[model samples]
Target: MARTGTRSTIGRTPPELWPSGGTLVSTDLLDDGSVDAIAVPLVPAVEGEHGAQPGEGAADVSALYGIDLAEIADRVGLTGASGESYVLQLPRAVGSAVQLPWQALPPRVVLLGLGARSAADLRHAGAALARASRGLGRVLTTAGVQGSQSASQAAQAARAFAEGYLLAAYRPPTSATGPAPAPSAELVLLGRDGTRVTAALDAARTAAAATWLVRDLTTTPSSTKTPAWLADQAKRLAARRGLETQVLTPRELSAQGFGGILAVGAGSASTPRLVVVRYTPTNASGRHVVLVGKGITFDTGGISIKPRESMVTMKTDMAGAAVALATVLAAADSGLAHAVTAVLPLAENHFGASSYRPGDVLRVYGGTTVEVANTDAEGRLVLADALAWADATLEPDVLVDVATLTGAAAVGLGKQRGALFGTDDALVAALERAGEAVGEPLWRLPLVEDYADAVRSDVADLRHVPADAGLGAGAITAALFLREFVGSRRWAHLDIAGPARATSDRHEITEGATGFGARLLLQYLADLR
Candidate 1:
């Protein structure tokens, strides 16, 4: 239900306005008049603790503004409790009476809880602040109040806070009832080391905005975002970002023998497309990394249709492709030195007279034959073609493929993390570190060599899926099938079936299109550089 012509905007503010490395300034030197709201972090009191007491931050606010924060907490039943938030409006007398920069005092003060003193807690606190400060124009925060941590830890906390705030502030309405509201708030970090905090904030904003782009693409209804539409988007992005783009049509696909993509997309009226996006920096490090994403714009499961209930959120099946596209663009925007390429195989698996049938033998791109067992396993087919193409042509140093491939992945990892399968331990370890650093957790699942037999075919080289429904290791079997394309190369497969779509709002993640791998992959590529 996205409004026509209403595209998601990226980097609304100019780069100059974005926080960056700069000279530090004292809190005393900052003009309070510039800030409409001031946010301070508070930790929870220990269990069985009684009367309201002033935390260090509250004490600082009390002395700075002449407001008794402890008394206010007592009256309002706030005990510096975990996950609790309280806001106080300062009267003109107290607001203007501050000793330092009395004329520049903020009118409102916010107390946010740091529950458990964990990273998750800090992110939630930041999300809460973002929701509360929706209408406020300029906000300032004191890094010292988050916790007694080192400079590195403080920068991390600041980055988390900024990410949470910006991501939670996003609202992509489906209805075109009125013009979308403009962003009202601007963030300012109050600390001694402006350069460090600025760099952290800038990085967080870039990463989060890229995530939002993925969310926008995935959340758009399938009807509006067909395979051609996705190709157009990639072309536009490439043009704007100075990346190289190539989109192959159905005729070209047939000529090149991309049977996997052609077979899966044959059912739909919209033809299939394979989009290649490359970012080659000047004098690049020569570390070629290829990323392949399953771009099923919509999945009706072809002839093997899903249940009515199961089809509700199937529009998110292309989340992997969206992440891939967003990751490459973000890397280019950040001026990374590594050479990156994204292969996106775009298609729609629909049910029609022309739909490819079961038991059909498909000679995939690299001349490997595959027997179609379950049409619902179409994501792997498209991904297989791109993987094979990358392997044959790109000769990448590291190859990664991402897809919302199986429900069994959700059954195994739940929605908290994606299932990662890889041949190289070093690549797997690096991806895990990146995922962890960006809060997109990935759990490594073994590519059981024994499970390779599950996908073996009687007539062809392999089967699209196991013939037996009761067979276990569904996620593993899918990964093994992809491994057939990339032989002896460092490869990793991310089955993001569970984490691609959010079941409910949590922390900085919205209720749809979680943008799972965009930031993780970008972080991984950045680490390589």
Candidate 2:
């Protein structure tokens, strides 16, 4: 049985109560009782442009609310700047109730600036509006500023906005403070074309919910989400999605010669587990894609313990597994035509008398011997076994592994993007495009063939870490080590250490577990379809 209950519907709008597209009524046609807030876009003012005439949307909003728009702008110091927000209380004229046959307008009017009119900018604006409208019931967003954009462009912008809003509203409880209050805000988009806007909203909602699931799993305490617990969750998810699921026990792993995983997991009381989930369509195209994740529930660095501070968020070491699980679920939900398989190598690396140490040679699956240079580099060890197993058993056409494998990646890419290393140029480009489309950007790092020499071992076929401790390219070396298990197959290694978690809330990203690779992998799978 799964230890945790079903996830809270904290960031979701109930299907029956989900906001529907409202008519694009003039501001004068809106009723005060219909909504609690109205959000309008405000672009930055041009150098020579008169501040009196802010924009068409602002003018319409000012006239509808019967307020002096210029005076409000001046009072609020709104120079039509981006990322700037100001809320104005609308005056309720006595005995001026209009019997308009349109959606009612909220009492509060929000002025949001459009910094660059880019998708990222739209997402940020949407998140800010969501945050501001927390206690408010419903918000009506007018897309007048984006009306001139093409239908597809408009839909993209709407999707970004919805994503931002839904993601911002998420707040998972950390203590016995009971559950956080459920978000009551309903997002209704007003636009020239209601059908297209509705479609965009639905799509964005699905994608955002998938990301929320990833966040929930990754943020759960490691003690509550052990290797077996994660496998059980995978099994349940696979059953619900009509996907094939297989979980291998520690005894089974040893029988199959997954020495890398067994050795890394020996120190932990909870044995390791390998979960394989497959989504195969009946008329599937032969484009088989395999996703491998490093599911280290908690990393204590075994005998080679990390600094006390470094282990603070060690529970997030399994972010890669969470991404893979969410991606597979999303792919199955979308009913794509391509066959997909997700291999999750789940384990907890702790220090104990039974712990595997340096100088240990692990015979990974597919018979590759890896010398353990550092016990702390356990993510790649487990992943190596999974990658080799998937390659040998699944023989997938494309293989991609996502892992929080190195801090060097964070140092190289910062927290803004993930490090992507791949054998195939086309695969790398596809992943890059997919990541960019979803705002989970990936920067390509070279898999310099010469770096392979760094892992060449004297006692074994390879070393898990670089031979020289001072050598740079830790991220690149980790990827190169994983490449050995893939043989000549097309593969991509995503070092998601940087973007998987955030130090602070920014844009659409929350403070914990950013769900970084879920959307990117989903997009990639969609393209394959």
For every model shown, what is its TM-score relative to the native structure? 0.90, 0.91
Best by TM-score: 2
Please list the C-alpha lDDT of all candidates, in the order they appear.
Answer: 0.79, 0.80
Give the Cα error of residue 493 in candidate 2, in Å: 0.7
Write down the worst ten-residue block by lDDT for model 2: 9-18
Per-residue alpha-carbon lDDT of candidate 2 for residues 1-529, written as tens digits (9 for 90 to 100): 2344444432233211133334434433255575777777777656687442354366666666666667777677776554567887755545657443222456788877666667777778777877777777777766334547887787777888777777777665443445565573777766534567667777677777778877888888876788998898888878987889999999899899999889989998889999999999788865888999999999999999999999999999999998888888777877777888999999999989999999988899988898988999999999999999998889899999999999999999999899999999999999999989888999999988888899899999999898788889999999988988997889999999999999998878889888899888988887763
lDDT of 1 by residue, 236-284 (tens): 8778888899999999999999999999999998889999999998888
RMSD of 2: 3.4
Estimate candidate 2's alpha-carbon lDDT, on a 0 to 1 scale: 0.80
